[model samples]
Each structure stands twice: as C-alpha cells, then as structure tokens.
Target chain A: MRDPFRSICDDDLERRWIWISLILAFAMGGLLGLYAVASNIHPPSNVETIDSSRLHLTEEFAEDKLGVKQNDDGSLTVTMVAARYGFFPPVIEVPSNTPVKFRIASADVLHGVHVPFTNATAMIVPGYISEINTSFPTAGKYSFLCNEYCGLGHDSMWSRLIVVPESTQGK
Target chain B: MNYSKAASLGLANMWVAFTFFAFAALLGLYQVIERIDLIPALKSPEMYFGSVSTHGVLMGFVLTTFFVAGFGYYTATTSLKQDVWNRPLAWFGFLLSLSGVLMAAVPLLTGNASVLYTFYPPLMAHPAFYIGATLLVVGSWAWCLEMVMMLATWKKANPGETVPLAMYGTTTNAILWFITSLGVTSELLFQLIPWSLGLIDTVDVGLARTLFSWTLHAIVYFWLIPAYIVLYTLVPRAAGGMIFSDHMGRVAFIMLLVFSVPIGFHHLYMDPFHAAGWKFLHMTGTFMVAVPTLLTGFTIIASLEVAGRLRGGKGLFGWIGALPWNNPLVLAAGLALLMLTFGGFGGMINASYAMNTMVHNTQWVTGHFHLIFAGTTVIMYFAAAYYLWPKMTGNALYSTRLALTQLWLWFIGMLVLTLPWHQLGLAGQPRRISSTPYDEELVQSWLPAEFAMIAGGVILFTSALMLVFILLKTHGNSQSVENPEVEYAESLHSTQRMPHLMNSFGFWVALIVVYMVASYGYPILQFFLLDTYGTVPWSI
Candidate 1:
C-alpha cells in the first residue's frame, strides 16, 4: 500500500527550499546593513547652535526649542525653556553651513528630535539636553518632529530649521 | 425566548460584521498601497486619513463589537441549549449598533473625523462621531446583559450541572466587557459627547484619557476571547484530537478575564496622570497574563501532538507532520498559532516598561497589532466561517481548494505586510501619516519597504476577493447538501466529570475583582490626588 504520510518524509527538497529562502532573506538583510554602514554620513563636525528652516511634523516635537544659539565674540550661550507638549520657537533662522551649538531638552515628556531631511534624529528626554553638533549643509527648509506619542496635541508639535544663504545674512 | 430565531438573528449580525470587516480589509489594502507611494494617484492626505480612520473604526470597533455580540448571543442560545430570553431586545441591540456605524461613517467618509481611530481628545472629532461610537458600545451592553442573564437562567434551570466550556468562556467575556467598557462609555457619554457638542467648557483631557485607559486594555482581551473560544472548543475537534485539558481552558479563560484589565497601564507608561508605582503594578499583571498564554500554548500543542501521534506519527515532534493540512480549521489554527507567537513577542516588548520606548507609537506598534488581530484572530475567524458556512446555509462550501488558498494568502500577505513594517519601525518611521512629504532621507529609506508592503496588500486583496467570491457562491448554491455535524475532539483521557473550578465562574469572578482592585484602585486615585504643574511627573 502506498502510504499517505510518505510525502512528509520524502519532501526533503521542499524543506531545503524553505531553508534556502530563509538564508537568502538573511543575506539580503546583511547586504542592506553593509550598505548603510558604507554610505554613512556624519552630523555637522562642530557647531554650537544650528537653526535654519521651517519644518512641518506629522506629530509634535517635545523639544522646548529647536536648536541652540551661540554668541559673536566667543561666548557659548544656551537658552532652555518650557513648552506644553510641543516644539516652541518652531522656526529658527541661522547662517548657511555655519557651526552653531544647540542644547535641546524637553519640558514635558520624552520627544524624538527628527530631522528627516538630514538623516539626523535623537531622543530628547525631559530635563536632559541632547546636544547635536551639526551644520546645515544647504540653505533649505528643513523640519523637525516628535516621533513619540506625547499627548493629545501631539500632531501640532513641529519645528523648522531654516538655513539662510551665508551671503544673505547680516545684510 | 427562541433558539432558532436567536441563531438566525445573531448569525446575520455576524455576517454584517464580516461584511464590514471585508470592506475595512479592502480599504486597508488601499491604505497600505498608498503608504508605499506606489500609487501616485492615491496620495491625498485627506483621502488617506479618511480611509485609515474609516478602516480602523470598521475593523477595530465595528467588526469586533458586532461579531462578539452576535457570537455571544449564538453561544448563549446553543451551549445553554435554551432559547435567547429576549429576541426583540437582541434585534434592538443590532439596530442600534448598525445605526451607530452608519452615523459615524458620515464623518469618517467626509474626512471630518480624521482624528484617527482613537478619539483621544483636544484633537476633537465631530460630535456625531463620538455619539455614534457611544451608541455602538451601548448597544453591545444589551448583549452583555443577555449573556449574564442567560447564564444565570441556565444555572437556575440546571441547578448543579456544570456550564459547558463554550458557554463558560462566553460568559467570562460578557462579564469582562460590561465592567471594562464602562470607563470608556462614561468618557464618551459625559466628557467627549458634551465637549464635542459645545455643551461643556474646557474638557478635562487628563481625566478623559484616564477613563479611556481603563477600557483600552480590557477591550483587547474582549476581542481576543472569541478567537480563544474557537481555539479551545473548535480547533482540537477540527484537528481530530481532544482538548488536552478542560481545566486548562478554564484556567486560561479565568486568567484572561482577571489579568487582562489592570494591564492598561502599559499604554500609559509614558503618559502623565498615572504614577510609576501603578504602572509597575500593571506591568506585573501584564507579564502575569503571559503565564495563561503559555499554558494555552502548551495545552494546545499537546492536544495537536496527541492527534498527530494517533494518526501514526513515530517520533516526539514528528506528529507535527501527521496533522491534517487541508481542513480549514486545522490549517488556520496552525497558521494562527505561528503568527500569535511572533505577535505575542512584539506585544511583550511593547508591554515591557523599559523597552516600550523603542517602538511606542512607531510602525512597530501597528505591525504588532496587525499580526495579532488580523493575522492570528481574523484567520481563525475565517476558519470558523468555513466550518459554520455549511451549517448556516445548509449547503456545501463553494470550493474547499479556494478557501484553503485564501487562508494561505492571508497568512503570507500578513507576513509580507508586517515584517517590513516592523523593520521600518526599527529604522524610525512613525505610523498614522499621509505621506513622507519632506524628509528625503527617511522617505528614501522607507520606500523599498513600502513597495514590498504594496505587494503584500495586492496579495491580500486578491485573497479577500477569493473569500468574498467563495462565500457568495456558497450562498447562491441551490441544492441543500448534507454535511456531517461538526465534531469537537474527545480528550485522550476522558473522564465522567470536570473539576469544580473548571466548570464554575463564581470563584474566578471574585478573584478578578480582588486582583483589579488591588492593582488599579490606588493607581487611579493617585492621579487626582497628586499635585503637579504644567507637566505631570508620570509622563507616558
């Protein structure tokens, strides 16, 4: 009698295909990881405060302010304020390709500082400053958003980093 | 009081619910495709938000509520083997729910109610939306009443005979939902409805959220119990094996009922108004619920093993291959279990107090739920439909082959859709958005995954079309076919009587009440008592 259950034992090729597919998937994942590592870009080398464009966010940013502001003669100044579950001073205009320092912190809850255009994002914890030393490479409108589920007014929380062309500034 | 009429009425309600579910699913596919940026024509923020909000409401609220109520009614009538006590009231419940859905859809379709599926206030929806949702919940409460009363009636009638396992689980959910939904129901009725209607000045957002949280977590278990019911009562039998332990099923149900409620704090881990101590306590309960799930897994696997071995499998795990693959229920159960394991793992990460921050509102949250609710629970629902269609219609299924293919496609499609979604979440993509308008880098990173998701949606759409076609064809078939009566598996070690607690809900209810009070009482009170400034210390 031809056994009905024989297919289970005999289907070695089918099992092998499953294994092969899984392996291929892992291989593709590894390749993607390698590509990410190879093409990695760094944040602006050294900046005290950086601000440049108006950005619209899908959710609110919990950061009290977008970025930091430094002084002219050589004094580094950081202003930290409180905002209610959203980003304040949403648009900050700064000179293009200039190094500026920013000390960013959340007043209410945990908020994610996401600069989608620049591939820069960080978690802004309440009462903790997340310092990112980066210069906006281009004069364009860039946006930051809170990627966290902060509160009811989450969607309205947005900030823009406006990078002005260097020649236009102090005109 | 009529059994046949109640069955007909309840089954019709389920059919309506499934129809809504199917509609939601099609919209879901469209939304997924739109998210992928594959269809340029389908990329409107208004339309996307509308479709998404409608889809969420239809699937999460409309589908689950109607199905649970209908199934509850059906089970109450059958397992009790008595007529439903109030036929008109049941129909009234149905009409109220149906009307509520229609009312809510007006805003959803117009995109006026794109506050997303969750009506977390301050970002307000139309008054009709809140009123409609409230009506839907209120209608379902009647069904809950019927369930408790029926169980009480059965106890009165039968005196000492143990309530059947099916009836036992149904009653547990009925009781749980009644106690559970009150928090949200009150929030909608008192706060949201009045506020949305301009009847109230400055709504208390914190209080409203707190109330919503109370219902939020328990409602998941409410949606889940029907799937578990099928698992315990139907799957074993479909697989040609007996349930491993009747006591185990009861223990699981009891555990779910008692433990599922207080764990809502996990959702509030990052929210204000709730204290750390409370969140920690709820986290413990959340983890404790895992015990029952593991128990269910063990019992279910063991049951399947018994069936597989009996079919002449030789080795310890070789029994796996011996199980039937063609039977819709068995196949669906197998697939559902696989999805459950992965979804449950994601759930554990989300429920974990520390790790939850990694993927709190990200696509990971969406992916996890889609896997569990759509992948695990909905697949079983399909299996149940397949098993019940013949009985309901008194005719044969249109095509077993098509049904089997649909099941496979659904499972495959879910994996295709959600796996990429989880990856995107890890790579930092937020859920509930129209498009990646700016953020070129994020959009570029998300595009490939989004494209993959579109393919998944297409597969799922094709699968859904097959389901609709098969069901319709089955309904249109002329001659009545004589199919065998559905059979539940007999236990390997059959006994004459079940354990007292296994057959009784009284002890479980008392335990749940105590657990809830011990867990939630102090936590909720602290919110009102704590003196906080602009920001509450207990942030989500």
Candidate 2:
C-alpha cells in the first residue's frame, strides 16, 4: 500500500498552524472586549432628561415614550418603554457629540434594550425602569429593533436613533 | 411482504410528498416576490398570507412527515430481517394522513385559513384546518406505535444481541417524535378546537400561547432527527467507511430526546405570558442541547477522516478529498454539514439569552431556518431518495449526472437565496408581509437581493422539476433485472458485541426520564406557582 496517510502523517506542521490560529483569534477577541470597556468609561458629552409623565404611553407604546428631538442644549433624551416583547418608543433623536440618558421601563414583557452602534445594552422588566446613560459620538442614523421575538409583528417593530450635528439642530 | 411491493409503496408515498413539496416551493418563490411588492399585480395581502402559510405546511409538515413514515416503514422491515409489523395498519395510517392533507388543502387553497400555521390564538384559522392537522398528526402516531412494537419484537426474538445501528436510530426518532408532538396535540384537541368551533367565546390567550410554545420549538427536532439519522447511519457507510463511534450516536440521540423538548421557552423569550426566570431556565437547556451536536460533529468528521485515510490520501485534511464525492450520499452529507456550521451559528445567536434581541424577527431568523431545514435537512432527503431509488425500483437511475446536477443546483440556489436573505434581515426586512411598498429608499436597496433570490428560486424550481423527472423516468423504464440488496457500510473498527448500557433499551429510557425531569420540571412548575388572573395559563 502506497502510504495512504501521506498528508495526514505531516501532523507536526498542521498542529503548529492550528495552535497559531487559535492564539490569534483569542487575542483579537480580548482586544475587542477591552476596547468596549474603555469606551464605556470615557463616555460622550451630550446629555438630556426625559420626563416619563409627559408621554402618552401604555404597554403597546412603551418604547415610543421618548421623542427623538433635538434640545437647545445640544443633548438628546432617548426615551424608551418595554412593552409586550420589545421597545415601545423605538426611535430616539439626539445631537451629535452629546451624552444622552435613555430612561426605560416595561409595562408588560421583559426586553433587552440594545443600541448596536453605541455597544450599549440594558435589560427591562415589567414595573421596573432601567436607564442607559450614553452619548452618540457620531452623526448618523442607527436603528433599534426588538431583538426579542415578541409576537407575530416582532420583525416589523423597530425604532431609529437619529444623531444630528449640533449645528443642524437650531436650523 | 415482497421487497418490490414494499419498495413501490414507499417510493409512491415519497413521490406524492416531493410533488407537494415542489409546488409549495414554487408558492414560496412567489411569496418572497410578493413581500418585496416589486410586482404590483401580486399585491394581495390575503392571498399572500394564505400562500405563505400553505407553503410552510406543505414543505415543513406534510412533506417531511409523509417521507419519514413511508421511508421508515420500508427501512425498518428490511433492516430488521422481517416483514412490517402490521401492513394493513400502516396503510390505514398513510391514508388517514393523506385525507387530512387534502381536507386542510381545501381551506388553504381557498384563502380561508391564513393564521400562519402557528398554534397561536387571537389569530384563528378555520375549524377544518385544525381537524385536518389533527388527523395528520394522529396518522403519524400509528407509525410511531408500529416502530416501538417492531423494535420490541426484534429484541425479544434476537436475545443477547444489539439491534442494527440503522434500526436503533430510526426507533429513537420514532420515540422522540411521539413524545415531542404531544404538546401540539393537546393544544389542538382541547384548546384550538373549542375556540375555532365557537364553543368558547374567549379562550385564555396566555395559556394557549404557552401550550403552543411547548410544541413550537421541539417540533423542529422532530423534523431534524431524521436528518441526524441519515448522518449517523447512512453517511459513514455511503462514504466507504464505518461509523467512528456507535456510543456517540447513542448519546446524541439520547440528548436530542431529552433536550429538544424542554427548551421550548427560547421561542417564548418575547412572549408576555412567560416570566423571565422560566425563559432563562429554558435558555440554559437550549445551550445544553449543543453538546450532542458538537459530539455529532466530532464523530462524523472522524469517520470521514478515517475513510479518507483509508482511500490512500495523504496530508492533514488532504484526506478530505480522497473520500468519494461522486456518491450522492457522500455529496449530500458534505453539503449538509457545511450548512450546519452557519445554521448552527444562527441557532447559537438565537439561543443566546441576550443576543437573540438583535436577530429575533429579522431576515436573519428566516435565513437561519432555511439554511437548516431546506439546506441541511432537505439535502439529506435527496441523498436518501437517490440511494434508495434504484434499490426500490429494481432499475438503475435514469441519470446520475442529473442527480449530481440537482444536488449542486440545490446547494447553489440555497446560497443565492439565503446569503442576501441574511443581509436583507440585517438591512431590516420583516418576514411575514404582502408588500414592501413603504420606505422606497429602503425597498430599492433590497431590490438587488430580491432579484438574486428570484434567480435562485428559478434554479431551485428547475432542479426540483428535474428531480421529479428522473424519478418518473426510473419508474417507467422496464428493466427486468433483479435489484441489489441494500448494503450498510462496515465500520473502520469493528466489534462483535457492545455493553448493555450502550446497546440496551432499559437504561436509555431511564436516562431520558431523569434528564427530562431535571431540565423541564422547574421551568414548567414556575408558571403554576406564579399567579395570573382569570384564565389558567396552559402548561407544556
């Protein structure tokens, strides 16, 4: 039999390569994690407060309590409500480079409120409120979709965070 | 009891299933198009939802169930070295299920039932749909009963011997499905029936959802076990090698039985009816099920590696190419595993307690399932059919070239359809819809992907037609040659007998009982302990 396991016999080289790749992958993952922690520590500047009472929100509109509006102070209050399976007031607006406080609560189902762009996340449960105090450093539109399969309409339920430049808010 | 007759009956049922599947797939193509609303004429939401629902049932429920039962009957009898346990009863079950399909088809075709094939209430379907679906499930129950009885009989006759590996896996599936479907069966009989019939003016939505949740997640495993069966029992043999580990196969099956059911709460992650604690518990169970899958992956790869090495291939991983690629079973298993990586990744994301929120209802979810069910599972169905057809018909396949082409086309088409589908989901495309008329800018961006999917659909439809064509040609050609006996591949490492725990029935069943109680006991009990007002929440 002509050495049937010829390529398989060169096991040392293969083992070496596998080890190298594994080490690199772990290193990259660790660096990414560290970067996330550092960014959270030194947050952006735009901050705004949302009065929960002024909004007409129920279980259905739990996510929509915060208007994505620009303030005179160049900050944004991204209001949120956890209704049924997702955020009721999904969309929030803020001025760029402003630190924002996202006041969130649930009227019904539990929800994981995640802002992918900011790498910020929090959990919301019924009758309890949680907040993500963060800032949008850049000007762009990032969407907030219910990652939870809340119900039949879960796919269509999403809100956007529109971060505008401070110069444009007055205009 | 003759081989030819049994094979004919099996092949006929398979043909019926494939035809329904082909037509349903065509409907699916239209559904994707209609959702984009690129074609204005196809803009009826009512028609769209109806077609989508029927398409789901035909492909997911009817096709898989019928193929499994028919194939199981033949494989069982032949592999066991005996006739079917009860030929008449099997036929009766077949007929009952077929009748139910036709009855359900009436409402589905007429657009009278558009409840999206889910057991969720408040969105109710016609009474006929429930009754028909019930009959179909009831019919499969008969097949399950036969499987258990046949296995028991075989054990009794062959004292102090291990059941054939193939037969063992099939019996495990039979057992798994019976236990799994009970959740849906209870819901349909007691809840959906009464609500649809107007016997109950207002049913408990939370209770009904909980009951539905029980079946929602596990049923996928019921669909999946047959695929895993093909992988463990058929794939190795097809590859010109023996199974790497029989113990691994047993463990995987046991895990599937124990874990597939209790993890239903992962589907209820977003439901208001369930508490976070219960959902979290089920999430843990969901992750636990991944153990068997990882085991399956290792065992299968090792088996393939052994085969490759045996074939005189050299270099680490170079043995991969030495294994037979021309064989349909080998080809399919390869493709199925490749899809499993991506499908399994999506499943992990879905199973992740927190990460699920990002991909919940997006095209990602749709893309994930299609990869698993259509990409992984259906390819195995194709491979099994190809391998078995010549044996069944006592004639060679009309064209192995066409068979190879069909499989290739299927793999390519699935990639074309699903790759963009994932992007479209990330781009925020909702799944169940009649039109994407809103957000023109957004819809325009989706246009290219939708177009690619259409092309993919065309290729798939053509491939499906070719599949039916080859089977039909094989059936018609009259070559009076004797069919070769179905041969299982010998293992690379062979043994005469195994331990009782690995080979015995009693130990495994006890293990299943203990596993189910530990996994599901607390999660289910929590619903009862926590108080809810008027209607009692249905417990799985």
Q: Which number leads on TM-score?
A: 2
Candidate lDDT values, in order: 0.70, 0.69
User: What 10-residue stretch in candidate 1 chain B is worst by lDDT?
Assistant: B531-540
| Model 1 misplacement above 4 A | A1-86, A89-144, A148-171, B1-3, B494-497, B530-540
Each candidate's DockQ score against the native complex? 0.06, 0.08
- Among incorrect, acceptable, medium and high, the docking class of model 2 is incorrect
Write the residue-wise lDDT of candidate 2 on A1-171 in tens digits: 454323222234333433453454345434433543554431111211222232254532343334454457755556567555345555566777676766665443334444543534454433334555566778887766454333334445556667888679765
Clashes of each: 23, 19
Candidate 1 local lDDT, B1-540, one digit each (tens): 335576587677888888888898889888886765667887776677778889989988898998888777776676677888777888898899899999998988887787667664555678889889988988898888888888888989887776777888998899899888888888888877887777774444455666777898888889888888888877888777788766567778887888888678777664534544566667667776776676667668777887788788779788999998899988998999999999988987777655555575668888999999989988887887777666666678888898999999999999999999898777667776556554566568788888888888888888877877887887777866585244444555443366666666778778877877887777556535643222222211
Q: Report the lDDT tens digits of candidate 2 across residue range B418-478.
A: 8888887666665555565434556688789888888878878878888888878877657
- DockQ-based CAPRI category assigned to the predicted complex of candidate 1: incorrect
Fnat of each candidate = 0.04, 0.01
